[model samples]
Target chain A: MMTTPSSITSNELNFLVYRYLQESGFTHAAFALGYEAGINKTSIDGNLIPPGALITFVQKGLHYVELEANLESEKFDGDDDFSFLQPLDLITKDVSELQ
Target chain B: MMTTPSSITSNELNFLVYRYLQESGFTHAAFALGYEAGINKTSIDGNLIPPGALITFVQKGLHYVELEANLESEKFDGDDDFSFLQPLDLITKDVSELQ
Candidate 1:
């Protein structure tokens, strides 16, 4: 199981999401999210972050969560059974419910 | 409609995919893809890419394709109707079929 980097703060994630929404042409959504998330206060370099970064980070995070769940159940066979599972289910459901 | 950067070569994309497969723990798949795509010969700096770069790039590309399709039909009201469409469907079907 991979450990998440402690360096990645919530603000960075929020900024990324805000940028993604703007890039995808969700101006109203982006503006709302930016306001709620306080993205204007972030000091992140927008140019350094490539487009789709938020989606990529979310996908990787989901995979890590699935991997952790598999390990805890002693079913860590390295098979990617949870690869197709949607992110929302994992986020909303208890970890035990996944197994 | 946004124009995809001409600087993004197919080799760069292949390398990103290769790195993504490796990061996701699909070792055998990564090896096969690397060999087929000649990723070993690519000079891309691995450190520059954050995890999930490939997924991010693909999502952006899919968005662009959807945007272009909407534009051609003169229905480019900035409404994101095709936001939920899967990447495979766009890749396999004709652009006209999407509408």
Candidate 2:
């Protein structure tokens, strides 16, 4: 089906499921699916992040917004000349490094 | 902080939250966060998919696996000569077209 048009195959979909299970910390499900589907051949091991990362991700984001609100109030209120050369001072690490 | 070490900036994290809210169909949340963070400058608009897509993704994947099981039992049982030149008969579309 790789040569077909407008169709998605099972392999691609299975990969998504595998990743979902892993990321959600359904380890047994991930393991079973990977084994059955032969998806482990692609070396998807050891990439599982703790399921709590999702909560951390959201809370961290909220904190950032709060900090931004405080900073903008203090720093940008009277500074008509202020322009963001880069939008936010977030992302200290390089994108490649994160990946 | 962009040049700092061991830090993730707010913008990066906010973008993630924005995407999460959008993809999860919390459009109002995504919109609010994007507006506050000035993330809309990057053109993340109109990429929102309904929350149902996640369910559909899993169901479709489960169906694929079921079909594969049926096919393998029928086609591979007696075919010791059988080797998967390609793993599954999935993904009719080119990867490029997907993106």
Candidate 3:
């Protein structure tokens, strides 16, 4: 059972992500645009990101996150990849309710 | 390169879930509570709920979702499990703003 923080609404966390990514003015838009139009074979959606799938983002080196929504890659702390998604927001409170 | 809806803040959607589940008073609290307390072996957190894990919820049939944050579960629409999570809220609009 997933628990939620009382102060931040989960919805707000997702919005923060959206606003941060889009408003950051740092969008890799051309690439992202191409990705959406199917010009790129790659995907960034959670459903598409399988477990253990490895992705390399240029200077970012090899990073791992479950890409296919499944955990296929064996668990190992010494693996060559420096990959992981930020933990999903656990805050349960509505952001507006915060002091 | 994930996409998001423009009108809805993801935060709001999460709140909708909280309101519905909590206010609705349909919590599987005992089971969920046990899972949370580490007094139970099962877990419901996204981190704990992997990509292709098979969970059998009583009378819910054998269901499959990636369980290990990795995609190890074979991809086939004909699988025997009746398991699936609701697609994460894809609403692009804030619920309050909705007409």
Candidate 4:
């Protein structure tokens, strides 16, 4: 079965969610985490990477690192409603911390 | 005790997070919940409302509703890293749903 993509985008809404995260304060938590992937391994540097992908940081940016060789590459194109489950189901393997 | 407010806002980052949620498919989950607050109670309508505030939907919009009368009035404002803690902490009382 296939679901059609519904077009939903707004500059205002985008600003709101980002501002929500900024107020909550979990931006630098990537390196603080220890995953089966790697404690030293990172991919999200305040940039919301796709789930199961390594979220790492650099001096200049917050980037998403995908280790395709070590990871199961599922065909998920673009960020859409399917992403709601990613942080919990796919991204953050360490659930207790997110709680 | 207080932390200084830092200025961090970006059009690109904001769009990224919003697109992430769209891919995950949680936009319409607001009214489907049963909370101690109220099963009929709704505040979030695809739009990310601030924690502890009521998020409601209307015919034309996704809006945030604040009920100061029945809720504890916390003095913190704006969305930040503080928001990363919201979905699991303040907004979602039903831990099982989020977990």
Overall lDDT per candidate, in order of appearance? 0.51, 0.39, 0.24, 0.23
Ranking by DockQ: 2, 4, 3, 1
Deviating ranges (above 4 Å) for candidate 2: A1-4, A42-99, B1-99
Better of 1 and 3 by lDDT: 1
Candidate 3: how close is chain B to the reference, as a TM-score? Answer: 0.23
lDDT tens per residue, model 3, B52-81? 111111001101121211123223333444
Docking class of 1: incorrect
A-chain TM-score in candidate 1? 0.68
| lDDT of candidate 1 over A9-84, digit per residue (tens) | 4455456545655665555545555555567877666666667655554444445444445555556455544433
Fraction of native contacts in model 3?
A: 0.00
DockQ of 2: 0.03
Per-residue lDDT of model 4, residues A1-99, tens digit only = 112121213322222333343343423221121221132333223333222111111100110111211122233333322111221111222223212
Chain B TM-score of all predictions, in order?
0.67, 0.36, 0.23, 0.20
Expressed as tens digits, the lDDT of each residue in B1-99 for candidate 4 is 111121112322232333344343433221111221132333223333222111111101110111111122233333222111221121222222222
lDDT (Cα, tens digit) per residue for candidate 3, span A1-99? 221121222332222222232342324422232233332332234343222111011001101122211122223223444234321221221212211
Off by over 4 Å in 3: A1-65, A68-82, A89-99, B1-24, B27-99
Question: What value does the lDDT take at residue B77 in candidate 2?
Answer: 57
Clashes of 2: 5
